[model samples]
Target chain A: MLLCGLTLLHALVSGSVPIPFATVLQLLGGQAADPAAGQLQTIILQLRLPRALAAMVTGGLLAMAGAYMQVLLRNPLADPYVLGVSGGAAIGALLALMLGLGSSLVSGGALFGALASMLLVFGLSHRHNNWYSEQLLLTGIVVATGWGALISFILAISPDQQLRGMLFWLMGDMSHSDTPTLEAMLLLVCVIISLPLATRLNLYAQGPMRAASLGVAVQPLQWTIFVIASIMTATAVQLAGAIGFIGLVIPHIMRRVVGADHRILIPASALGGAILLLLADTLARTVFTPMQLPTGVLTAMLGVPLFLYLLNKGRRT
Target chain B: MTVLSCQQLQLNVPGKTLVSGLDWDIEAGQFWLVIGRNGSGKTTLLQTLAGLRPAAGGEISLHSQPLQQYRRRQIAQRMAILFQHQESGFPITVQESALAGRHPHRGLWDWSDQDQHETVFSALQTMDLASVMQLPVDQLSGGERRRLELATLLIQDPELYLLDEPTNHLDLHHQISTLEHFSGLAAAPQHCVVMASHELNLGLRYCSHVLLLYGNGAWEAGRIDEVIDPERLERLYQHPMTVQPGSHGNIYLPA
Candidate 1:
């Protein structure tokens, strides 16, 4: 939480204009009486504040979804995108860009695409009220591959002029995000719904038969996790256009720090994810002064080394 | 009182019918040993009885109600199963793993309180795992893991225990002590146990009843003394058996 606060402050203060810490503090405290407060308020409140909140909520959503996905699939390498959500969202966003749709429409397209992919996976894998984890995972992988092929085909014929915007959306760009009230609400709801299931999820992480023997309704719990994770991944892709590493790595890092009890791990992963993305987004916007790099690129560059170092350190200890 | 009863219970795996038209009633304070050769439906029968799998045909009742009528939580409150294989997919402490047994007893928002912690600690101590309660489960040895699983089942504190090979990975001492513990548990007024095992001597020593699965949809169930003999054992195993009287009981050996 302290890290989240610090990152939020840094994101509000560091930009092209370089607003002073005191001024940022004052603007946040509703004291805008200073003579030069007008422009600073616009920069902090209008521009950076929304982007920072977007990053925070998007990060929390993705990380929580990723944690649940790992348990649901019983695989450490599972991520939010492992189920083809990002692939579907990427196709939607790229198609919107090709059609010269407005930014709002692009987000809408991505959300639609994500939901469609979720339904497809759920439908294909579910049979006779029983879906094995392996069967679901295999179905998702094959569908993701199909979506990957479609994505490549779409990129093949698009005109050169709109290619950059399409690429930005595919790689993840948060510059177009407005105030994140909806996504923030979504993150809160997901956290609330998931916290109650944390204890049950611990038993679930053991195996299905064990969990069932221990009093968990394995089938219903599995279905709930699938739906909840799908919604969260869809929301995150809508907000940030498929930002990658936070969802995959943040849960693992938090697991090492807080242990595997989902009660603590879920909240810790959310905070860790929020901080990492806030820091990365701040760097992505400020490092080059005028030109901005894709947030996904920066997240990968930052997260890969951190994950590898932690994994090695864990092994040594 | 009848703790668990199955009428015309049937169990199958793919194209093979392992057990069929079976009727059995497990009364309170009765310890039943389900003995079968390899490829028989011992595991499948136990799983079906525990509501972990659907029976091919039959009705199972717990406390005079259909097994399917109760919620999973309700069922868990009355019964617990110790599976044959234990796998931990993620890192968890021994204490935490055992504490999961308390899941069905607590409400959704309730955390593990002091009483539950004490219970878990005692259970771990019983399993001789108190000193390493904080260690990760993946770091435990096979025998230690099996004991940990037993400790978890003790913490669950169910009335009906359906244990599949409760002595799979235990050492000789642990095997004897664990069976003794279950035997003691089955002597309680409202408690009963149904275990699957191949240890004829131990089963004869501890269990009051026997369930013999012949691996071809044929089975026999009765008091251990009446249901078990060299002739029945030979037919059950498809091999000649010699029975030797030991100090504790009769031991069956293949000839």
Candidate 2:
């Protein structure tokens, strides 16, 4: 947690404008006295800080959502995208763009799309008191495939003028996300709701039958976790574009550090995810300065190899 | 006092009846061994009594109230079940897994406190799992995993225990030790233990009450001494069987 705060500070000070640490601190502390430093402070305060905060919130939400998804589905591979949630969100945003909708409306479209896919998967997987994980996974996989086809169709038909921006958004860019208050609030609410259910979530991961035997309200708990994860994924997709890998890998990594108790794992995953995405977003901004990359691209590029290495190492152990 | 009771309970699938028209009562300080051939619905009956599955047709009450009427946590506070199989989605240490048994007693926002830790610690020690407390369940041997399961049940400290194939993966020594532990629990006042098993000898030795599930929606329940008829045992399994009056208890063997 301390490391995440320090990294956030470094991110604020080391952006393109390179505002001095002292000026950044003064601005943060509401004590900037020099008029000459006002523009640099505005750039840091207005542009960089909010961007960093948004990335952290989005990343934290994604990781927590992924963790709970793994528990509810009882599948280690399950994530926010495993159920076509991100795909649905992307399709909604893309459809909005295809209609020349404004950016704000596009976010709403993404949230709507996410909820629709979530409901579809939930409704399809239901079968006479049996919410089998395999059935849910199969439903999610098919729905994701459907969303994938629609997203591709939309991309293929979109005008050339909007292609670059659309592609960047799909790849997940934090540059265009200006505000963080709503996402931050949502993130806070999610964390609070999730923390109380962590123990039940852990038991549920063993299986619905076992969870019920242990006295967990298995159906209600599964549904609650599912909705929360879907909402978090939708919020993340809205705040950033469609950042991946972090959601899937952050929980795995936190499990190694904090063990499998969800009480500790949830908070650890939240902080670890925030730090990871903030770092990835920073690299995305500064690595090729004149031409920034989408944050999701960098996360995947970095995450896949790291995840494989960890998995391989775990096997060896 | 009667802890659990069922009336006209019918457990069936789409076109098959496993057990039906059953009326049974379980009082405190009694151990019931559900014995039957494979596909005889022993597990189903146990699960139904645990409230994991609704009976096909019947009513069950826990302490004079409808079983379904009790909240899940309320049921958990009074009953704990050990499943036949368990899986983990993440790497969880044996100790951590056992600690999950405390969930029924905990408030949503409450973390395990000192007393809960002591309870888990003693359970681990009792099951001889203290040596591997930090090891993940996946890494443990089959016998170790079974013992871990027992350890988890021990910590739950429920008034009623429903175990499905509790002796599954245990060795001869562990089989006896685990059964002895359960016998001790069942001997205590206001406590009960129920298990589904194919091990007729073990059931004969330890169980005070016996329920025979005969696959075609037919069944019988009684005190073990009154129900251990060699002819009925032969009919239950569709084979001849020998009943030896051993020093400890009767032993059933195929004749």
The candidate scoring highest on TM-score is 1
In the range A1-317, model 2's lDDT, one tens digit per residue, is 78999989988988666777877888898776778677777888788898999989999999998988888777878888878888888998888888889998888888898889888887899888567888999999999999889888889988998888788888998997786898898888888887888888888877677788788888788778877888888889888878888888999988877777787888888888898899889889888885799999888877778778877887787
Q: lDDT tens string, model 2, B1-255?
A: 999999999999778999889999999999999988998998888888989887999899999899989999899889988877776556677887888788888888677456687898899998888989888888899989988988988888899999899889998998998999899999999899999988889878998999999999999899998998899999899999987888787778999
Docking class of 2: medium
Residues B57-77 of candidate 1 have per-residue lDDT tens digits of 999999989999999999999
Give the least accurate 10-residue stretch of model 1 chain A, judged by summed lDDT.
A128-137
**lDDT accuracy of residue A92 in candidate 1:** 88
Residue-level lDDT of model 1, residues A41-140, one tens digit each, is: 9889999999999999998999999999989878887787877888889888889989999998899899999989988887888888776668878888
Q: List the residue pairs that clash in candidate 2.
A: none
Of the candidates shown, which would achieve the greatest DockQ relative to the real structure?
1
Using all chains and alpha carbons, the TM-scores for the candidates as numbered come to: 0.98, 0.96
